[model samples]
Target: MCKALSLLANSQNLFVNLARVAIFIVMIWIGGLKAFQYEADGIVPFVANSPFFSYFYKYEAPEYKNYKNPEGKVVAKNIEWNKLNHTYIFSYALGVVICLIGILTLLGIWFPKIGLVGGLLTAGMAIVTLSFLITTPEVYVPNLGGDGPTPNFGFPYLSGAGRLVIKDVIMFSAGLICASNCASRILSCCACKAK
Candidate 1:
């Protein structure tokens, strides 16, 4: 048992590499989805309400609500509105950036310098995503009036969107870990050179 424990304890570098791979997988998958119509449409709520991103859209917050295109369902008018809003254009650009970050993070396994940038960028992206919890009303469950007022709605009550946004906390930490690991490697190399 102690032997196994020792092995595990000494495998921190392997684990960190694995984490980098995991981050790459997640970033690439999610970023690629941004190129799709449904995926682009899904982000409307977040982008429309975000002060950092709202300028990319021609319409306002509630205004986007009216033009929503449910996944897999095509609404011509909504598509037109999205095009006018430059929704797809923004998403495509965002996707490319995300994919690049993922590639850099993966390369960090061998090249610490590249990895450092990727890790920092990953954390930055996570921060922006987490901000949706505050800026996007869709993050919380709305009190959809039924026969009676909804009991579990609003702050402290997370809708699907809110749940997703909250998960970015994990990504934020992972990015920091990767960044720190790379920084350590870089410093060690510098120290060895000085000797």
Candidate 2:
């Protein structure tokens, strides 16, 4: 039993490290996408629907709607217009912020202090993303109970938005674990120095 427990405990660090690396990779990849034009366009729905983020799109809201056709084809001119708007500016800024978080988290590989801070920052971001499950309707699978495509309403029935945000829960836990581990190591190092 002791050997079994010991083996289980030893794998904890490996799993935690995997989670941390996963978050960093996701942040960098998603942020890099948001920095571009098409992705900037795609994120409009999410940003527009977000109460916390909607203010950024207030002035350009009409142009945003204008970009869409009945068939859902986005016209070129309005895409250009959106690219020039404050909404796009905010998105690009957000992208830069996400990329910075990933880079900082990566720095944790070399410095425990950096890791702790990065872990906390990533955890904060994960909390905010998870909030979307409540704030954004996109998270809920639409058309259920009334004989539509999606037969269920919540939880496992999540839409694309929900799937995206729900995955952040793991990141949140991972970040907390990373920070805790880093904190313990740092404190132990200090204790040794004092001794």
Candidate 3:
């Protein structure tokens, strides 16, 4: 068993292949959950209510907030979901994009290029989410002195947004692996080289 483990660890191809497989499985799992709304033990709600996901659930539109424009007048208002009609659509679209990126990453069809693009997009989303958090701190705090603190108490430290950031970082690392050593790696793991 130790010999086998050593052999696997020493094989770069095996490591990359395993990374690809693991990434694929994760994509499928997350995509499946989003596509089917699969709820296990009410975990979905808990995740949705998590503080890390607070940005996704509640957005404070610039228009709603009392912010002065260049002319010193309030140009943007504080926009809330109740007043918006397309929030759900936007949310679903973002979800779909994330799932699509995951699927493409799993397939490894474009080697490093596709994975790189996905990673960049994921990073962008994470940045946007972080910006939102910085811009709107109230959404994360408890309202009306509610029961306990929000679900995801340690949001910025380990929220859904943080998870995505980490995932994208891994994806980007994989992309680098593909970009730097794609030719040899593909020759060993994929059938592209045979043709």
Candidate 1: 10-residue stretch with minimal lDDT: 144-153
On lDDT, the leading prediction is: 1
**What's model 2's TM-score?**
0.80
Candidate 1 TM-score over all chains jointly: 0.96
How do the candidates rank by TM-score, highest first? Answer: 1, 2, 3
Per-residue lDDT of 1-195 in model 1, one digit per residue for the tens? 999999999999999999899999999999999999999999999999998999988888889888999889999999999999999999998899999999999999999999999999999999999999999999999988646555788999999999999999999999999999999999999999999
Evaluation by TM-score, superior candidate among 2 and 3: 2
Better of 2 and 3 by lDDT: 2
Please report, in order, the local distance difference test score of every candidate based on alpha carbons: 0.94, 0.76, 0.46
Model 3, CA-based lDDT: 0.46
TM-scores, one per candidate = 0.96, 0.80, 0.45
Judge candidate 1 at residue 56 and give its lDDT. 85
Superposed on all Cα atoms, model 2 deviates from the true structure by an RMSD in Å of 3.7
Q: What are the clashing pairs of model 3?
A: 63-76, 63-77, 63-78, 64-77, 64-78, 64-79, 65-77, 65-78
